[model samples]
Target: MKKSYRIKKDVEFQKVFKQGASFANRQLVIYYLHKNDQPHFRIGLSVSKKVGNAVERNQIKRYIRQAFTELQCEIKNEYDMIIIARKPVKACNYHEVRRSVEHLLFKTKLLNK
Candidate 1:
């Protein structure tokens, strides 16, 4: 098991929900909003019951947290991110999840921008 990227009690999530915009690719839906602080990225994961039961949901969350941790060094700052796991995620592997997140990050200009 891995420790999750702690989603602090900051206003980032609320800002995103109220003002941030979203863009989705084939694998994931990324909702992002810029903040005033220096390069801090908070991640939130959403897995619906339609994806699976408690066991499956937990598995998906673990995988997502792992993926984010793996990319921590490469990710940029000052953005709040929300990743919503779709049904396809349940059938995907860790690498697939990683690649999916990477693609979104790259596409959204969160890296090297």
Candidate 2:
């Protein structure tokens, strides 16, 4: 994901965690907060050490990023989003990761149809 599209600061993630509405499935949890001033989307991903060692964690993050990239056009702007990987995600593959991400987004009811 591009720097411009990612939520990089600790403050940003904390804000989303504290104030955003959330949705989750077995593999992913998504939090989102709408904003009128931003006019763009900011995505933050959290794949913790508990999910696996470094390689597995990085691979899962990559899969989630790719899934978000594919769905970028279909998602509305002006929102801050945080995606957290669940423990079961350690054993999954790309397609499954993508499906999990998409499923969580759908549950949010904020994605463009």
**Cα-based lDDT for every prediction:** 0.78, 0.88
At residue 4, candidate 1 shows an lDDT of 39
The segments of candidate 1 whose C-alpha lies over 4 angstroms from its true place after superposition are: 1-4, 8-14
Measured with C-alpha atoms, the lDDT of residue 71 in candidate 2 is 91
**Native-vs-model 2 lDDT?**
0.88
Residue 65, candidate 2: Cα error in Å is 0.5
Candidate number of the best lDDT: 2
TM-score of each: 0.84, 0.95
Which ten contiguous residues of candidate 2 have the minimum total lDDT? 102-111
Question: lDDT tens string, model 2, 1-113?
Answer: 67799999999999998998988889888989988888678899899888899989889889988998999988888899999999999889899988888788777876798
